[model samples]
Target: MSDADDAGHRRAGRPLETVLTRPRITAAALRLIGATGYESFTMSGLARSLGVAPSALYNHAASKQVVLQWLQDHVMTMVDVAGFGAEPWDTALRRWAWSYRDIFATHVPLISIMAVLPVTGAPQTLRMYETVAAGLASARVPTAQIVPSIVALESFIFGSAFDVAAPADIFETGALAESSPIFSAAVRQGEQIQGKARADVAFEFGLEALVDRIGRLRRP
Candidate 1:
């Protein structure tokens, strides 16, 4: 065929769509984890789920951990930090903490991965830290205390998020109820509190205490 005919034939064909990219890979990895737990996660498995060869994934990601890093960065982008600029530090932190907790409560698998992962190449994660740091500084918290404060807050948030995922009967004393009367009675009382999930109620209780303690840092 002549060059003109060949060019027309190419134009008549449907446009090819991009099959692999950082976003696509991140999404696929999250779905795989949600469906089969991270224990079953693998680069080959992800590639199969994405309808591509295992080698094709390497063009975008170096390893499974790299994809997980991408997922971590993407997840951080979901946290709400909007109150940081406009609200008092306490208010802003409450908003951010609730958002952060809610996300990881459902993403328990990622909590450990993110806790130990460095922020070197994670832009969204870095942005989150920057916002919180600036908010703390704005509230007159000492620069030296900012990092430590962040670490402490994150530790609580991670623990709270994990708690949110525990079985509903986690607090149940079972056959040992008679041995732990006071604790069992309180658990029963907590179950009677209306309108909120027990985990949420507990999280709010801790969040309030944390906010109070952190706010005190700004005072003499």
Candidate 2:
């Protein structure tokens, strides 16, 4: 599915308040950035990708910086989409984490851009802020504890998916049949698990860890 497919919400036509908020524009920019990467990302390039003339986009955003700002907002919105699944507060967090990771994993090009980029005033950067606020307001978690707990868990799941998608080096390795039987068996079955199955395995593993992390967070 397209990135726009994942945008997941919309208002009919344009609203007078703003033709495009930072988040909406950013979501579009993300599709371009993810598809083309920073090196290829330019205002003209984005316009073409969106099937609009370059100037048309200008009505919504003025510059690449503006587009970038919107993209940051869009990233944060992924959290909102995560919330749509709506389980209990704690359960929702896992579903949220999995949704976040899955969304990013599906858009690897954007993830690559985000790796070194520091997210500033983008709408979504306030994710932890919002989550913690909601947690506190809802009395689901404590002021002293929520921040680090979310950060640690978020980083772990994101990092795990990245490892699966773009391993530091997939080329270097030999089977350890005796020392690591599971690893050896995986090596043998490796070809069978190639293609979408491998991706599903990676995705499911990440999802399980993400959802199960709730128990860990609540424990010590």
Candidate 3:
């Protein structure tokens, strides 16, 4: 073909080539989810968001589950696991727990889905796990306990992420305060605490306890 013909052909194929990458697809999927929410998210909606046909999206991601896996992996990259090897195990665990909670605080919609998502094909997710597991092992945690320890930390982190997004008055007793004086008093005391947000305070409390408990799991 002539140079001009070759240029035309390349130009014709540019739309799909430019927009159909895994990154692009994942980005579009996130945008769609953010706009319409996970419940409303669909492959057709994702395709429309990217200005492509559903078939094109399907060509890259075989199913919605595949796209979700892509998103899970992409989000996992944001979690801070660097401290695992560089810092003491407890310090690394604290840093990772805080970072995980903060990152997922804005991504609460994905929490339920990711809880069940397997790490089999997700490299970034697997890498995060490997780093954490290795860190715990290096701390001398028993081999059989590593996975359970990680799961325990994750359960706390995920729950705290949801808590981070909760309303400031979520626990406000309001009209029920009179009948629930003790609980209401504690809530008032919590509100009176200075500096850190209530969520941060609660998370710190829980994380410190977990870190201390897990640290004890270290083998002699």
Candidate 4:
């Protein structure tokens, strides 16, 4: 009877720990920033979205940049490209590249910050780069080529992510039509393959092509 009463008491009590520490501000920031770029997304906007005044957010965050840093850190972790310690780098690199693409696709809205903002927060971007560099070292891809290779891979992946986020109108203005067909085709392609299959297929293709090019370049 006492145990039953204790169990009932426990059940009646709220588990407020998760509520007390609402650390998943990452999702909130990403959703807001992704949908409305940081420049225009205001405290009032966040409050409206959260069903609170512009003041409530102060409990969780101070500035938009804090929110941005939070989102950036969270997103980077979701992308598994950062390898740890010594191992054969090929699999890690492939995994990292593919993972990076998938996460970007998942957070296309949040990733726009990567353009002008300096990388910051919980997950260290430099550490990720260093980790990849260490992996390339194991792969015998040449000491001098390590940094360049990493930079190239990052540029390709991030550029693709940005392409996904950029508005079609940006590429289709009056003078922009000359290059708009490619964007038009890409839009069609995005519509055609707007699912897991699309991202997986394109990333795999690009990653393999890049690895091959790097391998050939490193050849003696």
Cα RMSD for candidates in order = 6.0, 7.8, 4.7, 8.0
> Can you tell me which runs of candidate 1 are displaced by over 4 Å?
1-19, 31-40, 193-195
Q: What is the lDDT for 134 in model 4?
A: 73
TM-score against truth, every candidate: 0.83, 0.56, 0.85, 0.58
Q: Which TM-score value belongs to model 1?
A: 0.83
Instruction: Give the per-residue lDDT of model 3 (tens digit) for 47-74.
Output: 8888878888888789998898788788
Residues 48-101 of candidate 1 have per-residue lDDT tens digits of: 998878888887799988898899889999999999989989999999999999
**Candidate with best TM-score:** 3
Write candidate 2's Cα lDDT for 121-187 as tens digits: 5436666557644753354454556666666665765665565576533632464447777766675
Candidate 4: regions farther than 4 A off: 1-24, 27-53, 59-62, 82-87, 120-123, 162-201, 217-220
Clashing pairs in 4: 34-109, 81-96
Alpha-carbon shift of residue 205 in model 3 (angstroms): 0.6
Q: What is the lDDT of residue 34 in candidate 2?
A: 69
Provide the global lDDT of candidate 2 against the true structure. 0.58
Worst 10 residues of 3 by lDDT: 1-10
Q: What is the lDDT of residue 196 in candidate 3?
A: 80
Ranking by TM-score: 3, 1, 4, 2
